[model samples]
Target: MSADRGLWITLEGGDGTGKTTQAVLLAEWLRDGGREVLRTREPGGSEVGVLIRDIVLHHRGDVAPRAEALLYAADRAHHVATVVRPALERGDVVIQDRYLDSSVAYQGAGRILDPVEVRELSLWAAEGALPDLTVLLDLDPAEARCRLDSADKPFDRLEAEREEFHARVRDAFLGLAAAEPERFLVVDAAQDPESIASAVRERVAALLG
Candidate 1:
C-alpha cells in the first residue's frame, strides 16, 4: 500500500435496498468534499468480473449453491486484485456496492452453504482483505421485492426461487451485522431514499474522520 493509501467502504443489502443508487451518491458526496473516491459494484467491476457476471446472473439453468458461491468468489478475487486493492494502495477511497459479506449472506447463509466452508473460501477470495466499513441497507424481503417493477429485468435463476430464499438472505445479512457491529451497520431502507441517504452520509462521515 502507498504511504497515503485510502480506506475501503462498501454498501450492502438485498435486491431492493437501493445499494446501487446510494453507492453512486455516496461516492459523489465524498468527491464533493474533496476526497479521492472510486465507486464500483460487484458481480461485474473489471473485464473478468463482467464475464463471470453474465454466467452467474443470467444463466439459464439453476446453478448449485456451491458453484454459484465459487463463481461469485472468483469474480471477487479478480475484482480485489484489479480494482479494490489497487485503488486502496493509491490512497483513493474505494466504495463498492457489495463485497465479501454479500457472498456470505447471499450464498453461504441464504443458499445454505456450510458456514465454515464459505468463511474459509471467503478468506481466499478476499486474500485476507476486508472493508473498513460496510453499510447494509436492511429492508423487509417482501417490501424490497415489491419495489422492483416489470421495468426491472426478469429475475435470475437464483431470484426465481421462493420468497423464502430471500427471507433467508435477509436474515443472514442481519446476523452478520449483529456479529460485527463495528464493521457493519444496518440501516432501515424501507424509509425514503433521501432519509436513507442522510443516514448513510452521516455514518460515512463519522467513519472517514
Candidate 2:
C-alpha cells in the first residue's frame, strides 16, 4: 500500500470476455511507454499456483463449492506473497488477469455462496492487497457463451457451468463495479479488441498521470 509502489491493474470477467487479450495488450502498452510491467494471471500466476489451477479448474470429479473457494484463496495467498506483492513493491506495473473479484463472482454468485464472505476470505488470504484499478470487461452471458463455443477450447470446470451460473457471475461483476466505481472501469467487451484496448489505455493513462 505504499504510495511509491507501482500500479496493480486487474482484468476480470466471465469466460470468453477477452480478459487475457486485454491483459496482454495493457502490459505491452505499458512496457512500450517505458514502464516496468509484470503480466500475471490468478490460479496460475506462480509456480505453486499452477498446480492449484489444475486442481481447481480441471479436476475430473466434482469439487465441493466451499473447497473450491478455499483453493482459490490459497492460490491467492501464495501468488501475492511470492509474485504480485513483490513486483508492486519494486515499482513494476502489474497487469493481472484475475483477482479476488473472480472469487467473489465465480464462487459467491455462481456457486450460490455469500459474495461478501468470499471477498473477505480472499482479502484475508492476500493480506488485503487490492488492485489499483480493475478493468471489468462486461459482456452478456449468452454472447460470452457463444464466443466460448466458437473458440473450440476445452471447457474448464468453471467455464463448463450452466448459462444461469454465468449470468449470475456477470451480475456479480457489475454489482462489484457499481459499488466501487473509482476502483473499477467496466467496459463493453463485445466491442472490437482494438476499441476495447483503446478504452483501457485511456483509463490507465489517467492513472499513470
lDDT of 2 by residue, 1-209 (tens): 12355999999999999998998888888878888989899999999999999999999999999999999999999999999988988999999999999999999999999999999999999999999999999999999999999998999999999999999999999999999999999999999999999999999988888
- Candidate 2: residue 192 Cα off by (Å): 0.6
Error of 2 at 46 (Å): 0.7
lDDT of model 2 at residue 145?
Answer: 90
lDDT of 2: 0.93
Kindly list the per-residue Cα lDDT of model 1 for residues 1-209, writing each as its tens digit. 12255888989888878888888888788888878888888889999998988998898877888888899889988999999998988889988988878888888878888766786797798799989889999988887778864438797666665789888888988988999999987889988888888888887777667
Q: What TM-score would each prediction reach against the true structure? A: 0.93, 0.97
For model 1 the TM-score comes to 0.93
User: How well does candidate 1 score on lDDT at residue 192?
Assistant: 83
Model 2, runs deviating above 4 Å: 1-5
The best candidate by lDDT is 2
